[model samples]
Target chain A: MNILIIGAAGMIGSKLTNRLIADGNLGGKAIDKVILVDVVEPTAPADAPFATETMAADLSSPGVAATLVEKRADVIFHLAAIVSGEAEADFEKGYRINLDGTRFLFDAIQAADGYVPRVVFTSSIAVFGAPFPDAIPDEFHHTPLTSYGTQKAIGELILSDYTRRGFMDGIGIRLPTICVRPGKPNKAASGFFSSIIREPLAGQEVVLPVSEDVRHWHASPRSAINFLIHAATIDGEKVGTRRNLTMPGLSVTVGEQIEALRRVAGDNVVARIRREPDPVIMKIVEGWPRNFAPVRAPALGFRSETDFEQIIRAHIEDELGGTFVA
Target chain B: MNILIIGAAGMIGSKLTNRLIADGNLGGKAIDKVILVDVVEPTAPADAPFATETMAADLSSPGVAATLVEKRADVIFHLAAIVSGEAEADFEKGYRINLDGTRFLFDAIQAADGYVPRVVFTSSIAVFGAPFPDAIPDEFHHTPLTSYGTQKAIGELILSDYTRRGFMDGIGIRLPTICVRPGKPNKAASGFFSSIIREPLAGQEVVLPVSEDVRHWHASPRSAINFLIHAATIDGEKVGTRRNLTMPGLSVTVGEQIEALRRVAGDNVVARIRREPDPVIMKIVEGWPRNFAPVRAPALGFRSETDFEQIIRAHIEDELGGTFVA
Candidate 1:
């Protein structure tokens, strides 16, 4: 099977690429050729079992999407998106990239003369709005409060409809915030979730902008990659018409995350996280969904770590050579 | 207020137009001019109190939408759409007209140099797919099973996002199946719902394709127009971020509708509804929502009649000039 990963330069995307290469197969079909695309030229793996090509392209620009999908990949992982803060700040750019760019890709595939492929799209929990129940149910409405979430929700609708029309086999996974994200912190409002943990473990100081009581749903980068793999290979018929699903995630408060960090790396690592109340971040975090009753994804064989301790353990083993700075 | 009614040739659009003309004002603002647009030129209301123009235009065609909103009408009622059955049979046309057409209009509004008008978008209950609770709540997720529903759901999302971004003052009202729709029987799967009530009172026979046990949500055409008007004039601040509301509707079984028909026009009119099971139509109806607990729309002052009898009486009074073929 030929594989294509859009936004392959990003954290989760790169990890997925490495995993696929290591496994050398997806859904029992050997991945013979891989195409990795992003806004900038992606860094290709130095050594790999299969053919690899890195292409730089902006999908939001008219006609670019058609060229990207000319290969007619057997499987496509669409993970490219404008983050929440950027989408909110730059409205036009946000819609252009998130909404129009996605539509262009879907339209390109639909117009590709019967070339239907399994499309695994990365949707975000931002598709939900606040004033939510303690454990938001699957049936809760998608009344997105932000432009980014609205675009993702719209993408979910399009994916479902196109799949129903047999134009593509599409599965959209609403991912939880990835904890202990590798590398430098970006501008995303949720970036603090990762930085608080990653920075402390790296023997650096990081600020906890919000209170420990602020609970959020999370899965490790590894679990998110696994979700993409499972979504790509799953029997789509079992998903029926509802192709988009809220992935099962561990719901933990900031205090619990700190506790988990203390357990894994001890008091020294825990002491690295400092309290600094940032009202802007706090206001943003307050509106986010706290937890979800994601029953379907688990039923479909998409699994994540049961707790934050395991998430931290995985991060240490994967990123720090089985050891944190402590 | 300068009012623009897209799909002005259709039943609800035309009635809404006449209602506006008759009232001579909308939400306390005196009506001055009305622009009516459709695929064909709408018949001008000869004695209309306001300045009126009926223009033939297809909104899906490029530049047409731009011209329609060029005047920047103070209140825009976007009621145009391809019906469900037609959209199902012609997928490309559905996306083109129902989806792209709406987007084109919205983009036009966005591009009109800060001309943010009150956009009253007419969405449908079809946006809510089947397998609903006995009384579907306002917060129920939009998992549309049909292309038509998908299109409407997408429109609602766009409206909400656009409004949130301050591009427009938009309110999307999800109307129930319009009972006793004044027209010849159309190809829509839901058309029979109205025909049984409409044709029977007109001394004509109509088929009851589904069983008596089949329940559906409904509002009179008057109520639908009122919902639109309320959506157009209501304090948008009250709606907040969730701009789309499932309008209040009466939940009635086919047996109840028949009983109302019998009560109003006697056994003869009830007998005019011939039972002929259409497996295809039955299959379509089976996937529709049966009831709703639309709390928000009513709280926001969008009201509907209490019973099906009032619905029949409304049709007789409005369409048949105060008389049915009793």
Candidate 2:
């Protein structure tokens, strides 16, 4: 089986690629080849038994999607997107890449004629918006508050439509904010969730934007990758007409996260977190959903970490040899 | 005040135009100019007091949106769309006109260099999908089962984002299926609702596609026009961050509708209806929401006809001079 991973250089994309390579096949089929495409060239695995190819090209560019699909991938994981903050900040670029880019890819797959690949799309919980009752159920409206969320919601719609039309078999997984994302901090408002722990563990002071009681939903990077794999392997018939499902994640307040930090790394690491109270970020966070009742996804066999401590532990094991330097 | 109506040649669009022209203003603001645009020439009212300009151009085409906004419309009623059945039948055309067309108009308003106009977008309850409860609430999730619904949901998203960014003040009114729609019948799955009564009232036999027990949400054409106008004048602050609202509608089962027909035109007209069960239309209608709890829209001053008999009477009075030949 041949697999293609778009946005293969990014966090979840890279991890999924590595896992697929290590496993050698998805669902017992031997992997013949893997094509990795992204705007930035992906790091090729040093030791891979399967044939691997890498390409750095912007999928949003006209004809790029068709050209990429020319190789006829059996299964495609479209993980590319401009992050929420950047997409919101740059309106034209965001829609062009997120909306137009996804459509182009789907259309390209359809244009491939005889080939119908299983498509796994990574959607986001940003698709849900405010005035939400404490814990949002599986069937909350997709009234997105941001351009990023809107784009994700549209992507899910297009994916479902194309699948319904028999162009491709598609599954859209609406993932939560991935906590403790490894590597340098990014510009996303939710970055603080990671920075509070990541920066502090790296012996640096971090700012907490909102009050300790501010709550949000999250999953670890590992869980996100797991979702992608599961979505790719699962039977599309099981999803039926409802092609998108909100992935499960832990719901924790910033205060509880701080407490988790204290329990895991003691008072020193927790004390390194400073409260500056940036109202702009706080306001953005305010409109976001704090939790989701991912009943559909859980019933479909998708799983997530139960709490924040487990999230921190996963971060340590995956990124830092299960040790905190601070 | 200048008013712009996109898709002015369409069925509801023409009716709305006539109403607006007949009234001369909405909310007491005299409409000085009526810019009527569509892919086809609109039938302009001969005695329209306002200076009427007709432009037969597709809004989805490049620069069309900016050109429309350049005329400095104080209020825009965007009613353009490919019908549900047509859109579902043609994927590319659907996305291009519905999704990209809406996006272009939104971006055009934003690109107007700070000219913010009141944009009243006509959305649809088709945004909701299957496994729906008896009555869908305003908080229901957007799991659009069809491409048409998906496009509308995406349009709603863009509308909200543009509103939030202050590019243009947008209000998306999710209209229920307008029953007793005047004029020639089309291929919409819900057309039978109108056809059964419309044909029989004309002393013609009408075929019912599904069982009489199938219930669906509906509004009158007058009510639909009312929604557009109300959406134009209502205070955006009252709508807050969520720009889309489900318009108030009367939910009636097919049997109830036929009963109303019987009450209005006697059993003779109702007896002309023949029921040959169609699983195809039945399956499609099965996913549709039977009713809606439009609590938010009503509190904000939006209203609808209270009874189904009133709806039938309104149709007769407005379309058939309060009498049916049959």
Best by lDDT: 1
CA-lDDT, candidates in order: 0.91, 0.89
Q: Write the per-residue lDDT of candidate 2 for residues A1-326, one digit (tens) a residue.
A: 89999999988888888888779888788999999999988878878779999999899999999988997988999999998888988999999999889989999998888888999999998898778887899888887888889889889988988898899999999998888988897777788999998888877889898899998899999999889889988988888888999999999999999999889998988888899999899888888889888788999999999979999999989898978866
RMSD of each: 1.3, 1.9
Docking class of 1: high
Candidate 2, residues B24-47: lDDT per residue as tens digits? 998899989998999997877798
Q: Judge candidate 1 at residue B233 and give its lDDT.
A: 93
DockQ of each two-chain model: 0.88, 0.78
Off by more than 4 A, model 2: none
- How large a fraction of the reference contact set does each model reproduce? 0.85, 0.82
Best-fitting candidate, scored by TM-score: 1
